[model samples]
Target: MADVLSLKQSILIYLERSGGLERLAEDCEPYNDPQRTEAVYRFNVSVHPSDVMEVDPELGDCLLHDPLTATTLFQSACFQVIKSLSLIGKLQTESQVNVILNYTHLPPFPEYTLDLCRFPRVHRPVRPVSMEGLVIAITRVTKYTQGARFLCTNDDCPSAGGFHHIRVHTPGATESAVVRNDFSCTNCRSPLTEDVKFRVLGGEIISGQQRTSTSESHCFVFLTRTDELCNSMRIGRRYRLLGIPAHVHKWPNIACSVEANRVQPWNKVSASFQRLLRETSSSLWRFSAVVAHCFGLHVAPPGSYNTLKLSLLLSLMQTTTDAEDTFHNVDLLVVTTDTLIVDRFKGSET
Candidate 1:
């Protein structure tokens, strides 16, 4: 409780010092939707560190990193800042809010396909609609041009095996060469070829639910995040991902991915669950996990990774004070997207 309070105070202080609401408004200038923007403005502004902290290392230097704070307040500053703009409809795409770079005002990305719906209430497969979930499995991958092949020109070099990441002068080599990291081969003295680099995350999501003793049959939820943040996903953590229900490829091998355009931590339990008392949604079982991490108190050696995942899911399941002790079911979400045509109708009605 104290930490969260302190975090909120730090957030308020940071925003005020950085330029407050008006400057934030300037950051939002890209979003041109007038009516939606106005209603969003009426929504209150509040900051919770867990929901806003920037954990990715690449973004660490973008804001002040107060090493003194045990949690490293520096990491989350940029995320919270960008979130402030997003809340007021100042920015359209949450893919990569450019706070680290200079404040160039590119027009807001026109909102297109974001559809919000009700996440599953029970442990059953919801029909594949455009939805969001906390990422359970994801991996970061870098794309290199297959053109980065290098073969020694030596006739008797013993081993003329091809290599990767070497710099070679191409067929149309007129300009001075880029530094070749590989040494001149002792056998052939040949250089390797080079090209640009690309990186992204590829993974599947089972609607972002952990396994339970009586878990329901899960469906394929393929999502991809193409940026530095793709690697930031933690196994037990939660994320609010946005994607459409679209099929790819053809026939028997055909697969479906969410085609994610937005990703953020899903801190507030689902919309329906939010109506419950605070104790029901959070805190009831949070102490044990916090204590385990803070004090490094392992009750027992976790037998396997699956066991650990099951334990984490178990920890999140706390019953409400009600007679039935209703479960707050925070496992998944129904995503929402606004249509431009619908927005126009809404605008005309207003």
Candidate 2:
């Protein structure tokens, strides 16, 4: 307890000295409106692990290994700073405020940075980890319990009337998993009933499979960040994600899922590939013909259906670079009655 308090104190000092408190205050200004009835306000704080290491090595290590506890302490420190700044009264009586620390700028931790295929063997539960893969699927936006208030059911209990036990959603926990009403009170040993009115909901995006190009291994990942951040991800795009790995219980077996803390789009084209493209820019037509001829030597004869093969290659390039908005998008509509040829082309494309 003493160490925790000291660590929290250190975090409070760091926030004050690093101008995190001032930024938090600025974030809360819009919520200060008396008529607003928001149940929760999330204040994102950008933190650089390198800076933290320079200031306090122990705290920095704690953030890397034990992120949940460290983030809780950071939240407590932010709340303390909020109260000291007299911004607490701006929120509703039942409102809960959260401080989200973004470690996006943190230098990669080599030991914890793992490949998708090695996830089953190398992953450490609840520890911060980083992985790179393509985003294959995404679910629609859903509501998750950010925080919930539970009241002791026993009327005669001393802790029943005055105090409310608040449960906040943590990484790896689901809304139903955290906000259930079967909790027993510590003071009176009474059942705690959830106060539905005080529940705070947040957006959730569940993405399926962080797949790699070289391996068949994959894992599920979900983003609990704000809606804007979650919605920014696109299918078929590769990304580097940093987060904690947790076991999700399936009926017969447990599967690993990453609770992504940060998502960054990764460039699929290698430096050598980019250089090759640049070198071939002047003789692009010749390069295209050569590439089409060599595209599928095993599935079809070389130089056969050169026009179709070149068109397919152009389609792929356009689709992959569509997000850049620099290239004109192409839509391919092949109208052919030759089923055998179509099948051969599809096999070659695959």
Taken over the whole model, the C-alpha lDDT of each candidate is 0.36, 0.69
Candidate 1 Cα outliers beyond 4 Å, as residue runs: 1-130, 144-215, 248-255, 268-273, 276-350
Q: What TM-score would each prediction reach against the true structure?
A: 0.25, 0.69
The per-residue C-alpha lDDT of model 1 at residue 33 equals 55
Worst 10 residues of 1 by lDDT: 38-47
Q: List, residue by residue over 1-350, the lDDT tens digit for candidate 2.
A: 33777787778667777888788889878877877755566777777777777767788888877888778878777777677767857553322666666776556556677555554543465667777777788888888787776778888876464324667766777667768867988788899988788677778887765666564765655454454467767888788777776543332321456676677777767886578677778885766777798876886699898888877777776334235565464555565677787777763432
**Which residues of candidate 2, in runs, are more than 4 Å off?**
37-41, 90-95, 156-163, 213-219, 223-226, 249-255, 268-350
Top candidate by TM-score: 2
